[model samples]
Target: MQLTQSSSVEIPMNDAKEVDSVTLEPVDSQSGMDGGLKAWLTVVGGWIAGFCTFGAANSFGVYQALYTLEGTSSASNISWIGSLQLCLIFAMGILTGKLFDAGYFHHMQIAGMLLYVFSHFLLSP
Candidate 1:
């Protein structure tokens, strides 16, 4: 009996086609208003406004002491006023976060600053 074995041969290519180079277009500078100096300024302004207005709550201790000494209102009643102010300040974060995500942070920030200034000006009397 005779057995034959066959070997497979591999073929090699001598020349290959070169692919064309790709060209990319430059990005426009003013694509959207979401990011830039204005946006950063808005964020900074919002933080300042929030701290100036809501942060006043921390002075409750001074007001409480004065109110107690004046004897016009009970300490318990004044405490509730401070608590309510604190609750509102914290709750406003929810709305501010949503508005900021919606790209309306600048508008909201400006409005908030105006309101803060106006409230103080009008309430000063």
Candidate 2:
């Protein structure tokens, strides 16, 4: 109630019907997620990537044993190498996921394959 030296009741008017009339239009932003050939291929690619990275980490026992036999590096140093490799693998997965989200999966995968091959070449000493 608002009064200026005079008794008067002012009822607040609501334009709810006008507001309700303003409907929202939905946008088609998200792509369809049908489990077709492409979707299955993506799943297989993910599986291969996961195995190559995490599976490599899991095989560190064999690596450590071989390295120990060869006397290539100390136990502590060899352990550090495995840990560093695993850390880099996981850390870079985030970067790769971002690149994939930005539609650069093929480019990134090619780069990764080249890097892997180059690393193997370096290890051929």
The TM-score values for the models, in the order shown, are 0.52, 0.64
The TM-score measured for candidate 1 stands at 0.52
* Strongest candidate by lDDT: 2
Residue ranges of candidate 2 with Cα displaced over 4 Å:
1-33
In angstroms, how far off is 6's CA in candidate 1? 48
- Cα lDDT tens digits, model 2, 41-124, are 988988998888677688877878888789988888888877988889878878878888999978988998899778658644
Off by over 4 Å in 1: 1-54, 121-125
Q: How many backbone clashes does candidate 2 have?
A: 0
